[model samples]
Target: VVKWNIDKAVKGDPDYIVDRINVHYNIGHLQAVGGDSTRPAGDYLLALNKLSKDQYLPVGPDLPENQEIIDISGEQMKMLASFPTPPEPHDAT
Candidate 1:
């Protein structure tokens, strides 16, 4: 997870901080309920990973996509669960 000062960003300053955790595969898209709405954002953040890779059970040549459930209730993001999707999902809400 990364933290960026919006005030600095508005002034064209590069005062941003970044923190990263290994989610185990390539993540494509992410979404949370009411994330972009006026209401409060959801507590869960879903990471749509493009490849399961070494993160899931062996499926030989047909590896399923991964959906990593992340908990954003605290200061840091925590990965709660990982689920498999046979078909790749383009986006989520």
Candidate 2:
């Protein structure tokens, strides 16, 4: 996940990137809390990955998909935690 320092971007800074974090393989969806609404939901984000890969322990030949929870309530986005989802490879909904 890349968190751009928009404060710097607005000021025409060439390097506006402030933070970057690794997520699971092949991200399918990136949903922000209350992002569909008009209200502010700037607290959390969900990285719906299409593949878990080495992010979690494998049960069989297939690795389960995952939802990586990211904390966006601070100056820098932090990967708080993650959990393995069902066998569905791309269940963003």
Candidate 3:
């Protein structure tokens, strides 16, 4: 459900998704202190990739065979749509 949508959003725009998730998830100052700050993004992608394949199952019983079928609720879809789109690049020609 939520996980699938998040996966889609992450795949759609890794940079934007990572930035927002990092800020929202708040890995904090210790994790952010480094020249290679995109580690958080990398870690997130790694985790998502693992989950997507069912390689890393949850702690309890296995989920359904079909996986979770997710329909974007009207409110959730609207919220996602409301997020401001990335700014367009200026024509330099």
Candidate 4:
């Protein structure tokens, strides 16, 4: 996840402030409800991770996708839960 200062960004002053946490594996996409049009975004975010790897039990070469539930309601983002998904989950709401 990433954190940005909107006030600085609007003035074109490099507002990217932090790198946040590095999830278990590679993340394909990050999404939230009403994210695009919402002013403060949403209180939660779903990290669509591509590979399970060490995140779950070994299931041969083909690893299940991981959907990481993140809590963005507070000052810092936190991983709340993880659910194994079928193979490739292109997108989520």
Best by TM-score: 4
Candidate 2 lDDT over 1-93, as tens digits, reads 888878999999989987788886678878888877799577888888875666677888788778888998888788888888766644343
TM-scores, all models, native as reference: 0.67, 0.71, 0.14, 0.74
lDDT of 2 at 41: 73
Candidate 4: worst-modelled 10 consecutive residues by lDDT: 14-23
| Residue-level lDDT tens digits of model 3 in 1-93 | 122347657578643332222112211112111225543331111111112223233544542111111123333311121111112211111
Q: Write the per-residue lDDT of candidate 1 for residues 1-93, one digit (tens) a residue.
A: 443457777888765433344576677877776777899575877778886666567676677788888887666678898889764776776
**Candidate 4, backbone clash total:** 0
Ranking by lDDT: 2, 4, 1, 3
Query: Measured by TM-score, how close is model 3 to the native structure?
Result: 0.14
Give the TM-score (vs. native) of candidate 2: 0.71
Model 4, range 1-93, lDDT digits (tens) per residue? Answer: 776677877888874564386678788988885676747467888888885666677687677789988887777889899899867887775
Clashing pairs in 1: none
Cα lDDT of candidate 4 equals: 0.77
Q: Which stretches of candidate 3 lie over 4 Å from their true place?
A: 1-66, 77-93
lDDT of 2 at 69: 88
Record all residue pairs in model 4 with backbone atoms less than 3 Å apart, i.e. clashing: none
